[model samples]
Target: MGFAVAIVMCALLIASTTESQHNEAILRARIVTLTAENQRNGVALHARLAACEGGPADLARSRAASALLTPEQRAQHLAANGPQGFDVCARMESADRAVLETLK
Candidate 1:
């Protein structure tokens, strides 16, 4: 009975790890899709923001939101939310290259 319980527990552990890996892969694929979408739509997004011109309300909202994010929170949000929350991905090539490498 003890041996059977140990075997069952081992199987459950393996299943859990497999499920977690599958979920992570799915999330990464989604991030890649979002990145492509962002690239496709970036021009329009920028034009709309630019058209806001000197709208103080829009500018203030942007500023206040920026102020609210800590560096770590920003990083975490970028990883989790992908391009949906972070459409402004004006990051350095080195860092972007690193991410591409890691994702691959």
Candidate 2:
């Protein structure tokens, strides 16, 4: 009866180890799937941000906003804020004009 009890305990131990290993494998697979999904979402978000940055609507809005400021005001704002301010369209147009002047 002692031998039988030992054998039963051994069987239970083996079953528990196998179940633990299976659960670990399942968790690893789930982690891999989640990581891949997270990477895909990050890439999609970056692409959307890139599209929005230079999209036509964004450009039009920038132009409309810049039109509210005269060229001299745009220049003064850029001189003060160093081109990263709300005068991005003005900066872009100034750069374009510079390029055109160079070409001429």
Candidate 3:
């Protein structure tokens, strides 16, 4: 009986770990997709701004998008990408910060 219970417990543990890994894989894939989209957006915005075509509407949209990231997410992004990650975070943070400053 004890051995049967131990086997059951081990199976449950393995199942749980497999489920967790599967969920993690899905999340990682999502992150990769989002990151690529964000990079493309950044490039587009940069081009628009360089051409002096980005206006208040662009800024407002950027601010709104930037606000989507929580402070914890911001920290995690910076931590994960090291110094290079700061560039993207800085852009988002600054856009959000500008909006906050205007309200103040």
Candidate 4:
């Protein structure tokens, strides 16, 4: 009876150790997955930030094209749009900067 009890206890101990190791492996895999996902997200965020930084330059070029227009045409365009695109780009840049700040 004593030998049988010792055998059973050893078996239980081995089973517990195996289970713990399995759980640790699973946790490690999850960590790896999360890290990769984080890297991808970071890359995407940087791309968006670059785009946001470029927005003003693109807008300036677009406005420069309007420089070729007659005064009346420029006035009509300004009156109709009133720098709305500039406002939108400014807002987007501000928001992206805010997100970056929080990450830091």
Q: How high a TM-score does candidate 4 get?
A: 0.52
Candidate 3's residue-wise lDDT over 14-35, tens digit each?
A: 9999999999999999999989
Name the weakest run of 10 consecutive residues (lDDT summed) in model 3: 46-55
Per-residue CA lDDT of model 4 for 1-104, tens digit only, reads 99999999999999999999999999999999989988997787544433333245467764566658754455455446545454554576578779879989
Q: What's each prediction's TM-score?
A: 0.43, 0.50, 0.49, 0.52
Q: Per-residue lDDT of 1-104 in model 2, one digit per residue for the tens? A: 99999999999999999999999999999999989987996676444323323345456664566567754554554455443333555555577569769978
Kindly give the number of clashing pairs for every candidate. Answer: 0, 0, 0, 0
Global fold similarity of model 1 (TM-score): 0.43
Ranking by TM-score: 4, 2, 3, 1
User: Worst 10-residue stretch by lDDT in candidate 2?
Assistant: 46-55
Using lDDT as the measure, the top candidate is 4
Instruction: Identify the leading candidate in terms of TM-score.
Output: 4
Q: For model 3, which pairs clash?
A: none
For candidate 4, the per-residue lDDT at 57 reads 44
lDDT by residue for model 1 over 34-65, one digit each (tens)? 99987876665444333322245455654465
